[model samples]
Target: MLYKRGKTWWVDFVDASGQRVRRSAGTTDKAAAQELHDQLKAEAWRQSRLKESPARTWDEAALRWLDEKAYKASLKDDMQQLEWLHSFLSGMKLPDQDCRASPCL
Candidate 1:
């Protein structure tokens, strides 16, 4: 379901495990909110059916990559660059990505 929170829109739905999940649809437009809601719901259903691990957030993935590169000669430079990237992004998620396998309400 799509609802307005302040000036933006949000989606709230029950996941496969029956937990309530609420997240920002990231837009104020009704049609856009509905599209986002559908996308998130479909992705959740697909993952549950396929028994795949939950999608990872961009930040989590980036940090994981940094951690795995301890032996890289430019690790320090990479870390600094990552910090800058994260700061710029504010919050990072792919346009249609839902980064939760379990209900992360």
Candidate 2:
């Protein structure tokens, strides 16, 4: 369900775990709010039933890669590569990144 708090629309729903989630939909439009609410509810269901984790960002993956490859002799080279990639991929979700459009690819 959606309700207006001032000008912004907020969503309220119960997840698969029976936890009540209340958050701003971040939009003033009713239709957009409804769509956001549906997406959030669906994501919660998928996470609970399919054991799916939330999408990871490029920075998280880069850090994990560095951690796992810390013992490698070429760790310095890996760090430099990651530093270059960071300017292009920072804050982007892994699945959302388009390799085809990237010059690095």
Candidate 3:
């Protein structure tokens, strides 16, 4: 969650269910705060994988890439492109696209 502590802005991890757990290493600069954000995301992901698969589909990978790069100057336009791309590919077969497959029973 994003919070302001004194003169610094922090984006640390708060447990979704627990609501009281906090993982914060205070940072006074934007770059450091961002680095901490990445570290927290990584840690959360690692923890989550213990309960479920870490494997992701192509669609999820694309979405993750978009999220990671969304702070860039081209973010708005990139989002537009993503919307268009998703729409265009909605019902199309993507056998070569490296997506998750459902095996025949």
TM-score for all predictions? 0.63, 0.61, 0.35
Model 1 regions more than 4 Å off:
56-58, 70-74, 80-105
The TM-score obtained by model 2 is 0.61
Question: Please, what are the lDDT tens digits per residue for candidate 3 over residues 27-63?
Answer: 6787777777776666566656555333445467567
Q: What number of backbone clashes does candidate 1 have, counting pairs of residues 3 or more apart or in separate chains?
A: 0
Residue 92 of model 1 has an lDDT of 63
Stretches of candidate 2 exceeding 4 Å from the true structure = 59-91, 96-105
- Global lDDT of model 1: 0.80
* Weakest 10 consecutive residues of candidate 1 by summed lDDT: 90-99
| Model 2 lDDT tens row, 1-105 | 999999999999999999899999999999999999999999999988898887889999999998888999999988999999999999998774457888543
**Candidate with the larger TM-score of 2 and 3:** 2
Q: Would you list the clashing residue pairs of candidate 3?
A: none
Candidate 3, residue 78: lDDT: 85
Q: Report the alpha-carbon TM-score of model 3 versus the true structure.
A: 0.35
TM-score-better candidate, 1 vs 2: 1
Question: Looking at model 2, which ten-residue stretch has the lowest summed lDDT?
Answer: 96-105
